[model samples]
Target: MNTSKNRRLVILMYPRVREMDVASVNDIFATANTILPENRRYQIACLSTVDAPQLDGMYGMGLRTGPLYSTFRGEIDTLIVPGGMGNELTEPPEKLLKWMRKQGSSARRVGSICTGAWLLAQAGLLDGRRATTHWNQAHLLARDFPKVTVDPDPIWVKDGNIYTSAGATSGIDLSLALLEEDHGRAVALEVARQLVVFLCRPGNQAQFSVALKEQKTENTPLADLQIWMQEHLAEDLSVPSLAQKAAMSERNFQRVFTREIGTPPSQYVERIRIEAVRRKLERSTQSMEEIASACGYGSADVMGRSFSRQLSITPGEYRSRFRSSGIMAEV
Candidate 1:
């Protein structure tokens, strides 16, 4: 690729970085360049510690990376750090941490994927900033770095010049957002299409899937109750109703559901309803009233409040930002 006008995007690699995290983000930018007619594209580079000439990723893939000293040249416009098993260590290599502190201070934008947020926190780049990491590691990150506010829900987050994402695939989501910022929504959407992903997911979208949340525990009664609730979303799902379905008293059912599902029964139902509403809003052009009714919110006004409370976006705004263009035309 031509380097003259291209923006420099350096991906900092470390031992045991997740291959998917690194490759997915790189592929998004690389693919964007191929699809865009513009001559200037993002120029990507892989860099590692001086002692580690060849970096080995989580999946045993070996990548030859430039020495950390190369980053001191200050040509980096964007810096991305990918995460993996290495982040579990209490202390990262001192040399790499120093390089991150320097590059992150000078780079136009700095970001991390998955557990990479931990590294950013260690480098003091994310202190007092809203950030996220893989859902499984979010608590640990917060515990390790009290100054950073860790939100485990978002697929990605942009706090000023810093960005962080939830997991491996979420790295692609963060990169697409960066592409949108650098290029435009049209270019990002085209890249998403070329990659055969659904249109770029909004950064605010939850990283956890509905299915994953519902199946988090192996309690057969609770599992069956969850299925019943999903199917009967439009019906009454109050504490008494759900308790009856689960063949338990209301108090007992509430306790078990909360313990297993990691959320109260009422809250769980609300999330399911919101997720259903979101799907309909993105896929169908139905009136808000119709969608609200179908999704068990009773009315558009009620659903509007739920959307604002849970997603910090109105139903109309969510549809405008996330509705697939092709689906919109068909609707």
Candidate 2:
């Protein structure tokens, strides 16, 4: 089989950087290297903006990073900027932003992991383009750089040769996509299996999970009801049923639930059911009818509409894209 040409992957690191963001991208490419011939492997480097030989990272870890000056003029196939806690406290050095713009212009592709998108925006590299970062920090990115369109929903966003991924693990998904582009799906799948991650999440996948979003409800009754809803998905979850369970009138329950949860009770129940259906599809051999019934849908068709409404993809399509080899083995 023919493989693509070797590519140079450069990671730009800084003090207080999230170690996972840097490591995830590096590991994906490194794992791919173990499966590829020398001529087609990625050339990886971790460089720091500071002149120091060692840099402090988040969670009390120290990283050994090469000074950026050493490779300022070298050819770069792909340049990656990783997000850091420092992004919240201080701006990156002017020198680094200058270098980033230069590298971003020349490299075949440039990308960011998490808040690393901040640096790209600061460098004016993301001006007038769509991008995403860790969802928690997504608002700040958009507020600080109004010129850049920020979409917080996706695991990643790619515009032309620039890529930006949400959070740290999304970096893994981004790297796998890049690997698949350079090599093939088979090579990427092998690396994913070795790493024990989903093969590769699509760029448009939601950044946050349904469970995480549901946990944000502060109202005690609503919070308890959210948990109950998950456990009783197959049961009736209409406002009247939920209201009766909460011991409140249906009118009052609807008002309070919408105010506290930011979504109506019915919508929240649908989200929970869809999440359940998604997991079943990814990990089990259960037929669509079984999954739909278990997850509280009236039927497969009812479940399919809800899944497509939120995910823009149908249940069967989601299963085909995400059902891994391990799960297929069980069948």
lDDT of 2 by residue, 1-331 (tens): 2355788889988888899988898899999999999999998988878778888898769999885654556788899988788684477678778888988889989999998898899999999999999998889899999999999998888898899999988888888878877887678778889998854566766787686776787788888888888888899888888999999999999998888888888888888888888778776789999999999988999999989999899999988877641222211
Task: Assess candidate 1 and give its lDDT.
Answer: 0.82
List per-candidate RMSD values in Å: 4.9, 4.6
Model 1 stretches astray by more than 4 angstroms: 1-5, 51-53, 67-74, 88-90, 93-95, 217-267, 279-286, 305-331
Candidate 1, residues 1-331, lDDT tens digits: the string is 1234579898877778888987898899999989765667887887775456787778899877676654447578899988888685658768767877987788889999999888899999999899999999999888988999999998888898899998888888788778877776667777888888864566777897675666888899888888878888899988998899889999998899889988898988898999988877866779999988887887899999998999899999989887732222111
| Candidate 2 TM-score to native | 0.78
Q: What TM-score does each of the candidates earn?
A: 0.77, 0.78
Off by over 4 Å in 2: 70-73, 217-265, 275-294, 304-331
lDDT of 2: 0.83
